[model samples]
Target: MAGKLDRFEKLINSLSTWLNWVAGVGLVTMLALIVADIIGAKLFKWPIPGGIEMVGFLGVVVATFAIAQTQFLHGHIEVEFVVTKLPKTAQKVISCLTYSLGMALFALLSWQSFEFGRTLQTSGEVSMTQEIPFYPLAYSMGFCCIVVFLVLLVQCIMTMIRAKK
Candidate 1:
């Protein structure tokens, strides 16, 4: 059981690392697009018609995709003073509870987002300017949220297990 859990933890960490790299690439691409748009508008008196909309879409993608990586890296801010003061066992229990709640919340969010995306896709929704489909982006965000929740849950479980030892 312990070995299995250890493997799970390693898998989660590795997956998160890969996701983070993809997120980094998305961010870089977004930056490049923005710069190109600006240069085109300023120097050439030409603007990308859907540039703003596309960037917004990509921004959502970048942010959502990076969430799991951020949580895995312990990059989320928390007021740990109270938690730190507790006994080791108590802290582990609290951590478990916290992560459980996080999982529930994220699960709910992901479900809702997916439902919304499905509805949008069914209706063929489109943006105001570029007429870009909104469902794909929403779906991606929902998926990322799910992934983040799973990673956090795994981390919490691992922490609890180690605390027992």
Candidate 2:
């Protein structure tokens, strides 16, 4: 079981790491786009059309895609000062509870995002300036949220296993 869990964890971590790379790319792209936009607007007097909309979309990609990797690395903050004072068992319980809540929250976000993406696709919703389809971004958010949910689930399971020992 431990071996299986370790393998699964590795797989998820690898996927998360890949997603993190994508987030970094998105961040860099956003930076370049904004810089170009600023330069064009100020110097050339020809700003990139839909630059703002593109930046907003890339921001979402950067934020969402990095979440799983962050969670996997225990990079997210927790009020550990209070939790550390508790008994070991209580700490484990609290950890499990929090992870469960995170799983639930991310799962719901994934579901709702998918539903919204479908709606957007069906309605042909798009950005005003770029006319870029909204559904792809919504779908990306949904996928990223699922990755977060998976991370939480793995942590929750590990916590439970530790509690049993």
lDDT tens digits by residue: candidate 2, 1-165: 999999999989999999999999999999999999999999999999999999999999999999999999999988899999999999999999999999999999999999999999999999999899999999999999999998998999999999999
C-alpha TM-score for every candidate: 0.93, 0.97
Clashing pairs in 2: none
Question: Which 10 consecutive positions of candidate 1 have the poorest summed lDDT?
Answer: 8-17
lDDT of 1 by residue, 1-165 (tens): 879877877887787788788788889988998999999999999978889988888888788888888998889997889999989999889888889989999999899999999999999999989999999988987888878887977888788768978
| Whole-structure CA lDDT of model 1 | 0.87
**CA lDDT, candidate 1, residue 20:** 80
Off by over 4 Å in 2: none
